[model samples]
Target: MSRLRTPTHPTYCRVVRASAWYDLVVTAGFATPWTYVLVHDVLSSGGLALGFEALPELDTWQVLFANLMGSVVVVWAVLRIVRPLPEHGLFDGIARTLFATWQAYALAHGASGLLWLFFGIEVAFGVLQLVPWRWGRNAGSVTNDASPTDGRSDASTYWK
Candidate 1:
């Protein structure tokens, strides 16, 4: 098996926590209609000021989708913040990769240049999160599906 150097435990944990905090702050606004209204305005204004395409006028479907995404991401971020585990980072990285892919697709279809800012962050965090798993080491040599306190070998304990 090819082994790549991975970040130490502390570094990996810090990165995970940082990503969680970022998600909590950024996505919190989209979690509700009241907040999404303000967030939309801010993003639109910012995009225009930066000479990028502003977000289109709000639609019920768009708001609903954004709310759903925001709610799920906020909950996920909270979990990571509460417990910065190696597994959390690995999974979160995978999620970020998926999100980045969709974001890129939207951009290609002329969604908005402002999305580039979020895309960059997602890619950076995703790469950092997956690097440890890509190597033989699972975030400071932490074994996947292994519990330190119990001797169970079930995969259900991965998130615990």
Candidate 2:
């Protein structure tokens, strides 16, 4: 470690990077099934079914639209994994929390049990990202450096 004392701990960045990689894996798994699930009910024989059962019959176009959306998520996950940005954590956390709430709502409306597990995970992820973003150390503060303008050793320029 460089021994630069910043508000955000050094380890926090690693954790965020790891989380981004996890997200990448998860999204890839989901994206891999997008076309297959959109066209065929592959899990019907394995005692499991995902997505809306009535969706296929109700509107074929809707399934295609959902598949396209999944592709977008996959791309975003790849970007996050390749270049983790802690500054964007709060927005991502808020989005995950919203998704979890929606999943809970779906479960309440008699959705599948798998969504329950996803809801828990989404909520946990949201908390993990949000907590560090809000309560962890702030970045870009120097305790040892002096400001040229003020001629003081204890100088801090904080950015959120």
Q: Kindly give the number of clashing pairs for every candidate.
A: 0, 2
**Count of clashing pairs, candidate 2:** 2
Query: In candidate 2, how many Å is residue 66 off?
Result: 2.7
Q: How accurate is candidate 2 locally (lDDT)?
A: 0.54
Evaluate model 1: give its TM-score: 0.82
lDDT of 1: 0.82
lDDT, candidate 2, 1-160, per-residue tens: 1223322444544555566666665554434445546334433332254443332232456555555656776776665555455544555677788888888888888765655665787787788777764332445443322233453322122111
Candidate 2 Cα outliers beyond 4 Å, as residue runs: 1-7, 29-34, 38-59, 135-160
How do the predictions measure up, each by TM-score?
0.82, 0.61
> Considering every candidate listed, which one attains the maximal lDDT?
1
Candidate 1 clash pair list: none
